[model samples]
Structures are given as structure tokens and as C-alpha cells.
Target: KPFVRRLRGDLLAHGVPRVWLDEAEIDIGDSLIAKIDEGMKLSRYIAVVLSKKSIDAPWVKKELDVAMNREITSGEVVVLPLLYEPCDLPEFLKGKMYADFSKPDEYEAMLAKLLRRLRIT
Candidate 1:
């Protein structure tokens, strides 16, 4: 939660345009599915925070699937995986590198790596 908030803030501070959906941004009467679909369509990249909790989350799985498909169809890396903890990564992500953030001390290194991966100046 806090890590994600921090990441979002850091990304924004770097002048990277980002779209993140939280309960506060989603209206109570709005459709979550529609919002997610629109966000994915407009986003240049999808940063998936992988952890034990998110790995089993259905919505996360769905988001990963969509991102992976976009990567295949668009012939570009759309999904950027940020590993928060050790877990069995899905087959699609196996053998691929991730931005490691398992250690608090690694935040700067990981953020740099992530920005490089994003091609941010």
C-alpha cells in the first residue's frame, strides 16, 4: 500500500504521466471493469506489483493476462513486473527479469531500474 503510493509519487515527480485506480478514484456507482478496460487501453505500460497476495487475486491475474496479450499483439513490453516478495511467478513471466523491491534498501536501485525499463529521462 505505502510502497505503491510511494512508487506512484516518485513516478509522478519524475514527470511520468501515470494513471492509478484506487477506491478514492473510482466512483461508487461506476463500473470497475469499464474503468480498468479504459485505463489499459490508454496506458503506455502496465506495472504489476507481484506479491503473494496479488498472485492469487483474480483481478490481478486478469490484468496480467491483458497486459501479456498486449505485449504479444503490440510487439512491445507492456507489462513491467515489480517483485515485492518471492512467489511462483506465472509461466508467462518465468525466465523474464523483474525490478526487485523486496528489500527496503534496494528502493533507489529498483526505482532507477524501473525508470530505465520505462525509458524515462
Candidate 2:
């Protein structure tokens, strides 16, 4: 709920675009390579909503793998993850830094922080 709401608000506030793998135009068929390629090609930045559920999801893991690779290969596709619920963030995201959305003010602050982190502010 929070993820979709925040994403909508972000889309409204900034005309920055976003895409979901499930709703993507391409046919992935659970292919790792295909998902990675599509994600990198279609999105300028990737926001992974990390939680125990998403963190353990195979799709999320694959996307992160692709995002990490893209980060290395092109230094593009910035992966900005928001905490939907309290859970342990993976090592990769843990090191890069993330905005906490555990509180209302923190969430809003994180939203602003994300803009600044991405240099949109």
C-alpha cells in the first residue's frame, strides 16, 4: 500500500517514470536474463520495495542481481529501495544506504531525501 502510494505520489510530483516487471511489455517467462535486460532497458532507476516478503522473493532477488550488474556495467539504473515493513536489508542495499519509511514523517522525509539523493531536488 505504502509503496504504491509513494510511487504514485512520486510520479505525480516528478514526472519521473517507473515500470513493473509483471506489467512490462516484454515476455520474460521467469527468465533471469530477460528480466534483467528488460529492467535495465526500460527503467532509468529501479526501486526495490524491500521487506521480508520481497526480500525473499525470487523475482526481487533476480531484479537486484540485474540492478547490481547494471550498476557495475553502466553505473546507471540507480536502485532505490524503500522499507515497506521492518526487515533486514540485504548487504548490497545495506552498504549503499537507504531511506527509512517506517514512520510517516520519516517516510515523507525519505521521499524528499530520495529526491536529493538522486539529485532531483
Candidate 3:
């Protein structure tokens, strides 16, 4: 998974501890809401990998809704999305700034700009 790889890369580069779920065999079905709730509560930053496949993914929607609700309620969580390819950012994340990883130089530039936009390094 590109997302899992990229996230692991970022965490390693930044020396941040992270928990990855893709490798796990745990099932998330009827308890998806509770799982997402826990993930939202545990993670400081939540990234929803948007794509043709992810557009209708229930989990993606849940993640987005959880992040948005958290932002509205607590104003502490951040959604930092890294676009792996060209795709609509959906209405939920439409207005908010997002990173475009379409090209190396361009993505790098956007990364710096986004850092400035988010007031982080």
C-alpha cells in the first residue's frame, strides 16, 4: 500500500512512533464506528487516501467524518492528505488545502507550501 509505505517513511524520517493497521488481521465490521473513534482519538493527524477506489469506501468516509467532527468539536486534530494521484478531494475536504503528489518537484514545493500553510515544519 502506497499510503502505508509513505506513512511509515514519514514516521521514520521524523522519528515519530506510529501504529499501522494494514498489516493487522483484526476484523473491523460492525465495530467500525468504535474502531474509527479510537483511531481518531489516538492519532493527532489523520490522512484519508483519496482515489477512485477510495471515493466510495465506507472507511474513508468514516475517517473523514470522524476527523471533521473532531475538528469542529475539539479543534485539535488535523487532516493532512497526500494525494497519490489525480482525484477529486470530495466536498468534505474540498475547501481545505491539500497536497498534490503528482510530481516530485511539484509535490516537494507543495509540501513546503503546505507546511507554511499549516504553520508547521
Candidate 4:
């Protein structure tokens, strides 16, 4: 969660429009699934933080599934994964490349790689 917040801040600082599904952004009556779908539609790329926690999350799986669908249909790189911890990736994600974040010391380098992947300079 901390990494997600930090990444969101970093992207915002870099003038990248990012949509985060954290609790703070949720309204009292907001529909979680609807919000996620809307956000996915608005985003050019979806960054899935593949940590141990996220890997087990159903919501994350759903989001990734949606993103993968977009990628297949549009024939573009829509899902960019950040592997924050060692975990068995989903079958679909196994063949896709991901930015490694397992080594804490290499955070900046990984961030740079992510930005380059996003073509954000």
C-alpha cells in the first residue's frame, strides 16, 4: 500500500494522470467495481503491483483480467506489472515482462524503467 501511494505521488509529480483505488479516494456511496472499470477505461496503461498481498487479491485479479482483455483486443501494451515480491504469477502474466522491485535498493532504477515503459521520459 505504501508503494502504491509513493508510486501515485511520483507519477503525479511527473505530470502523469494516474487513477488510484485507495480508500481515501472512495466516496461513501461509491461502487468499487464501477470505479475500477471507469478508471481502467480512462487509463492508457494499467500498472499492477504484483506483491504477495496483491497477488492474492480478487480485485487485483479482476483488474488485471480487464487490462489483459484490453491489451488483447487493442493489440497494445496495456498492463505493466511491478513484481514487488517473489510469487507465482498468473498464467497470463507468466510470459509477460515485469519490472522487478524485489530488491529495495533498486527502487529508483525500477521506477526509471517504469517511466520509460510508460514513455513518460
Of the candidates shown, which would achieve the greatest lDDT relative to the real structure? 1
Q: In model 2, which regions exceed 4 Å deviation?
A: 17-39
TM-score of each: 0.93, 0.73, 0.70, 0.91
lDDT of each: 0.87, 0.71, 0.65, 0.84
Best by TM-score: 1
Q: What's model 3's lDDT at 9? A: 65
- What is the C-alpha lDDT profile of model 3 across 1-121, one tens digit per residue? 8655754565445445554454342374637556557666787777666677786788788778778887878776477776767787788777776677666568557656645544456
lDDT of 1 by residue, 47-104 (tens): 9998999999999999999999999999998999899988889889986789989988
Candidate 3's TM-score:
0.70
Ranking of predictions according to TM-score: 1, 4, 2, 3
- List residue ranges in candidate 1 displaced over 4 A: none
TM-score of 1: 0.93
Candidate 1 vs candidate 3: the TM-score winner is 1
Residue 112, candidate 1: alpha-carbon lDDT: 91
Ranking by lDDT: 1, 4, 2, 3
lDDT of each residue in 1-121, candidate 4, tens digit only: 7888887788778767665655656687888878777777878989999977898898888889889999999999999989989998988999999999888999889988988887788
Q: Give me the displacement of residue 120 in model 2, in angstroms.
A: 2.4
lDDT of 4: 0.84
Between candidates 1 and 2, the one scoring higher on lDDT is 1
